[model samples]
Target: MKEWWRGAVVYQIYPRSFLDTSGDGTGDLPGIIQKLDYIANLGVDAVWLSPFFPSPMRDFGYDVANYCDVDPLFGSLEDFDALVSQAHALSLKIIIDQVYSHTSDQHEWFMTSKMSHDNEKSDWYVWADPQPDGTPPNNWQSVFGGPAWTWDNRRRQYYLHNFLSSQPDLNLHNEDVQDALLNVARFWLDRGVDGFRLDALNFGMHDETLRNNPPRQHFETEPTRPFDFQEHAYNLSHPELPVFLERLRSLLDQYQNERFTVAEIVGPEPLQEMKDYTKGSNRLSAGYSFDYLYADDLSADLVRNVSADWSDAGDSGWPAWAFSNHDAPRVNSRWGGENADAETAKLFAMLSLALRGTVFLYQGEELGLPQAEIPFDRLQDPEAIENWPETLGRDGARSPMPWTENDHYAGFSTVDPWLPIDMRHYALAVDLQQRDEKSVLSFVRDLIAFRKSSDALKTGSLVFLDTPDDVLAFTRGTDEGQVFCIFNLGRTQANLDLPLCTQTEIKFSNRSAKTSVLPETIPAMTGYWL
Candidate 1:
């Protein structure tokens, strides 16, 4: 089988905001099908759709109610089949989000387990008796807020939930549960999914002893939730996670196609966890963290640190990189700051594509969309609402995609969308950029094409080059060819003596000085590939 995912570019689509063919104020599978050509035109190798299964909307589709079917809100099983067929016709591989750690309370497994202690499925979910004083099993806190355990009157025991109470964690220690989850994967594999983005894979299991987490040393200010007060040593990231991952990979091997899996790992020290998860061929294909997604600034030191870690991650380990996604603020607003413009956006595109791994490009990122300003009344994300004013909620990044400026709701839908479209996004609409030669959209298309055409940029090794304080420079190469990638990640222009070589072709650049000889100065937020 061909490992097509190696250094491939995957486009992430949050179905709720991509396009709404259905007039029910929400985007659906048909909507994604309608935009398949638009996605293919961007030159991405695959399209990863966020969860579309039946969900109660508490945590959106992360709380899966059915493992094998699509939600009526999105479409039906037939709609999904049509989507897969259309996506394949465009030569776009389909990767779906798989929330394995938790499921909605409405799930049949949870319903049967909650009915009685003697039920056939009683041990499917994580359940424990209260303490002597009827308190929660431990001091663990949910990612949202409050205690991680919620009491159930029917079962007369507290069930574990690392997130919202409605989303209960599964008992991954149970071999039965593991078998059931693997079957769910088989069902999707039969349906033609090329890969899965495993959501919170580390949270699938817990300490059987139910031990309290140790307190963390003071580093930053007060945290958004009590969950951050500790190192999360006992409540999550159990030693058994790697074992489960091995079993998942074995299941993928059962199929003839070269199926892939990328785990979404988030912990205090995710770099080591990422390495452990992808240590060998028996484990995951790749993994990513909140590294750059939540970063306050993009700097030379940060890139060098991450690059060094992955370089030391051993031969079989692979890394997947992303700068923005549905859960975090846009890069233009995060790193670009107030002075962000078309130039900065173009530079970021070059930098991300030049990295040494598979890259994920989120919706609206190609247009250089900044974070939207959503009012308190317009907020829909539970985490944002609970920690408002303190954190810039994710809803701003998940707003409807602006397709055209003249149409109502920016051509996303005829009726109002679940989340309002950002007014500023109208000027950067796809239709407008399609006509402008120098738009961010056009620059991204050109960058992707350049990366695809160059063996050095697509599947080469990386070596960090010694450069100035504000400049991030690296050389990507193979025995056949090599090229230098340099970016001025600062707000002011940087002047430096760049390393040079023969056959120094200028493959791509933004506001850059085009020359075979090294340019003495690079403009602020500019990037060049040589």
Candidate 2:
């Protein structure tokens, strides 16, 4: 099978906010089908839709109630078929989100499992007897907040949940459970999904022994929740995860098309974990971590260090990089800070695309959208709400996409949206950017086109060049050709002496620059491709 995801660019869509054709203050599958042309025009290889399964809205759609069916709020399975048809018509692959670690408490499986200690599905979920003092079995903590174990009165035992209490963790140690999850993947593959974005793949299997996580080795920074206080080695990133991934790969092999799988890994030390998850053909196609998601600044060292970690990850191990996503603040706010500008966004685009990995671009990232200032009352994310005053929450990055300047809800819906649209984003609407010759949206489109055309930028090997702290320089070389990717990440202009020959051509640049620089000063927040 051909590895189409070698360096493919994936556009992520948060369905609830992408578009609302249902007029029910929420986006649906039909709405996504309506925008297939726009997504295809962005030049992305695939569209990764966030969870739209039948969820109870606890952790958005991450808490899945039914694995094989679509939720009414997002439309039916036929609506999803229409979406797949339209996307394939546009030559775009569809990668749906898969949440296998846990399920909504209301799910039929969980509902049955929690009934009694002798039920047919009793061993389907992680349940254990409480300690002598009636406390949880271990020191694990939930990702959202509070304890990882919730007491179930029906069984007189505690059910484990790495997230909300409503989301009970599945017992993958059971072969029956594994088979069921694999069947879910098969169902989606039969329904025409090209790939899957596995949510919290590391959390799929936990330490069956239920060992308490040791205290964090280094903790200079203030811990947000109890989850950050421990090393999370025992409860997450279990050693048996690769075995399960192999099973998933075997199931996907039954399909005729070259389908792919990407795992979303989060841990204190994620580089090694990411490598393990995508180590070989039997594992995931790629893996991404929170490396650049919550970063406060984009420094040369940060880029160099991350690039070095994945540079030697063997041929079979592919890295997936993303600077922004639905669960984190926008890169414009985190990296650009108070001086968020189009140039900064452009620089980020250039650097990310130039990396040696697959690319995942979140929705609204092409528009250079700033983080929305969602008030506390409007916050819907459980994590953001739990850590409000200390953190800015993820709701800011998940506001409705601004398609028009003055249309109702920025052309996302005729009625009000589930999440309030940021009124200030009107200036950066998609239609407005389409008219501007030098808009960030246009720059993103151009970057995607260039990346798709260039063998070096797409699937080349990355080699870093030593430069000043404010400057990030690297070379992407493939059998076809080599290109130099240099960026000025600093706030002030910095002079650099080029190490290239005078005959070097300036292939692409956010700003015009000399190819052969004896002493050329790079402007702030600018990038060049030579």
Candidate 3:
């Protein structure tokens, strides 16, 4: 609560895509430590690291086989400690992902649990007996695809997996499982982690009776998989999740410094669930949704709707926002698809930062970078390969960060990169952007610094200022005063008469032009915070 992640700017670094040092082609902890200066220079208050724990990497380290140690692929535990030390030395807090909802099937606890129904860890995972026909226990589908229930011959039972079958969901109803997971979290807290971005926190609990989820009125079709058809009411977002979150927060409270926990809770009825989980101080610090990341456009109504819903939810339940991350494609691609404008991308970054809560800037977002185009032969993400064409999936978003243009691998690795460096990204490399005053990266640093110095924008209340199509406008203010923010989301100019407001100044603009110039038309992909 003290380090400013609430209404603060947090940078997300997907380890595999950030910067590689081992020549093995994958980015690691040491690489991250080396790049801390770059991250710190961006004026972010915190760094949110995706999973780095030991794993078979079925879901790129989300499938943890060990909670305490760093994987050999990422480097030794010493590397993690070193990274943590270096990050803190720069006064940058570190918030690592905690995937306690599930572990890889290869995890010792799951292996032992699946071996028998009466083992010491048998109840650690969600297990149910097969029906009389010997089919799966329920008809629920995995987020990855197919049945959520995976049959294991060893125990003659089906284990629950909200995601992939490899990621067997943990049974939070079991006291021992909850205790063990909290102890795992405490280990990191003792080792000096400032917080955890709790992965799939709502997934900790499931229907104990193994009830079948009712058929959906609509299965939201996407380019990803066939699994989007159902409402997912039973498989996830159970009412019991808040109890576990409160329990998790209780453990975090015992830590020395002000340790925070932000839950990545998504699915149906997220607004209410997000509020319940974070409303009281005894629970999580904050929670976010897939709303913005899944969107193809950022519109005025969409922005106001989410903010108004959270505002209606009550004040204590804070919200955190992001437009892109390791799981979602780059916002540029989402906004512009195949032909995205660099100008539009920069405008989008500014738009998200001006929202009501703390902002999350995924790596490369500041550079106005588009998603990396992964070829079929070199595609590293299973989700992308599973469902291609319609869904570019997340692999495109996880490509290695381009630090330079001359190097064969864009200065990301000495060996062939884990994923090929897109030629488009090389030209927008950090080295080039840092030198360009008009670059998106410099604009990002300026925006963050401005947000920090101004208390109104930093911890302000958001009020929607109405606007027409392809434009977003709002006012962010506190007890001190207010600043009116506006954006044109289209490539062509948006013509509109300004709303008459007295105490407004052109506080910030994504473009070079000032708001007072009174051009008859707002230029393409331009915005101003007044």
Which candidate number would show the highest TM-score if scored against the true structure? 1
TM-score of each: 0.98, 0.97, 0.95
Which residue pairs come into collision in candidate 1?
none
Report the Cα RMSD per candidate: 1.5, 1.6, 2.0
Model 2: per-residue Cα lDDT at residue 337: 89
Best first by TM-score, ranked? 1, 2, 3
Task: Candidate 1: list runs displaced more than 4 Å.
Answer: 499-503, 512-517
Q: If both were scored by TM-score, which would come out higher, candidate 1 or candidate 3?
A: 1
Q: What 10-residue stretch in candidate 2 is worst by lDDT?
A: 510-519
Candidate 3's residue-wise lDDT over 191-221, tens digit each?
8899999888787788787777775675445
lDDT (10s digit) by residue, model 2, range 1-530: 44888889999999999999989989888889988999999999999999999999888899999999999999999999999988998999999999989999999999999899998999999999999999999999998889999999999999999999999999998989999999999999999999999998878888888898999877867888999889887888888778888999998988987898988888866778888888867778888757898687788988888777777545547889999999888998899887787877887888888998899999999998999999888889888888988998888989999999979789999998888988779889999999987898998999899899988888888888767889988889878889888888888999887657224666667764555432377888888887
Whose lDDT is higher: candidate 1's or candidate 2's?
Answer: 1
Clash counts for the predictions, in order: 0, 0, 1
lDDT of each structure?
A: 0.89, 0.88, 0.82
